[model samples]
Target: MPSMKEELDQSTTPPLCKTGCGFYVNKETRGLCSSCYKADVLKKKASSEVPKILDVNNNVGNQEPVENHDQSNKVVKKKNRCHVCNKHVGVVPFSCRCGESFCRLHRMPEKHACKFDFKAAGRVVIEKQNLLCVADKLEFRFFKWWELPDMVFQSYHGWENWLDGLRLKKEVKDYLEAKIARRKIV
Candidate 1:
């Protein structure tokens, strides 16, 4: 059985690749032949890749390019050698917070002369994590029980056992108690 799209395509004269690749067009290839579409996609990917730092620096005055964080992460992942000594950091690479991977010898900031301010970064992290709550001072005025009115005492006093409740006969209490047994409100 043919799909709805295939059935519809069969009715039409069959669109060719926009690039004139002499092949039948389909939705998957985006109106292009499979090979042509793949080549196009690869070309687009290559063009979209982050420009080198040197190229970026050269073009700084002409136009400001958007910073890509994914490129930065990729650079870190690709760095298997120390930026300082150029030694290969095998297996477990010691990655510094300075956005550079280093060998065991030059892992420390002091060894590599890393310009990243550790104290400032730490301060910023602390500031973000430890939020200082700004609120009006709680005006909790302490009061003595004797100083309060009788109305306040009536509600709070003997809250569990209602002393002012209507007195029920012992037989009625037993019947209700049996029916409501083992049931808690919560």
Candidate 2:
């Protein structure tokens, strides 16, 4: 059976539910079945009432406004909250292998083997709960390989070593070249 997203993509006209119900995808929504939309509204209302953060008086309140925190003693200074997991991430939290700043829930194991390279030259995570979004994973893998340093990236067999023959960017590659040249002359 075709999923709703598949059906929507296939239809020339805007797709309606099989029940002939028109959906309000406009204003604060994507494609949502009527039942789901109502449920979402209710969920939002309930969630809005819940205190997301503590106020100055230590009472429940909405998200706190951003302010610089001075914590010189702590090893990890809490900076911002993770958007996905809603946990306080310390200053300069390591981006997940997925490029998402997941507090802990969505991040993969922090190991070299778990890292995936994205198609657009950046980092991404490999493992997941499901394989439904495989294309995204592949793109992310390519990105990581292209953008970040690989194992032994400083060595001759590094992936970007092929580009060694190409003209180097003076601003970016000059420092490394200088160090190498100095070592060779010594």
**Candidate 1 lDDT by residue in tens digits, 23-99:** 88878878898889999999999988857556554656777757656654664346888888788889878988888
Instruction: Indicate the residue-level lDDT of 164 in model 1.
Output: 27
Residue runs of model 1 more than 4 Å from their true location after superposition:
1-78, 134-186
Residue 71 CA error for candidate 2 (Å)? 45
Candidate lDDT scores, in order, read 0.70, 0.53
lDDT of 1: 0.70
Candidate 2 lDDT over 131-152, as tens digits, reads 4554434333323323344444
- Compared to the true structure, candidate 2 yields what TM-score? 0.17
What C-alpha lDDT, on a 0 to 100 scale, does residue 110 get in candidate 2?
Answer: 46
- For each candidate, what TM-score against the reference? 0.37, 0.17
- After superposing candidate 2 on the true structure, give the runs of residues whose Cα lies further than 4 Å from its correct spot: 1-10, 16-29, 52-186
Cα distance off (Å), candidate 2, residue 173: 99
lDDT of 2 at 121: 42
> Pairs clashing in candidate 1?
none
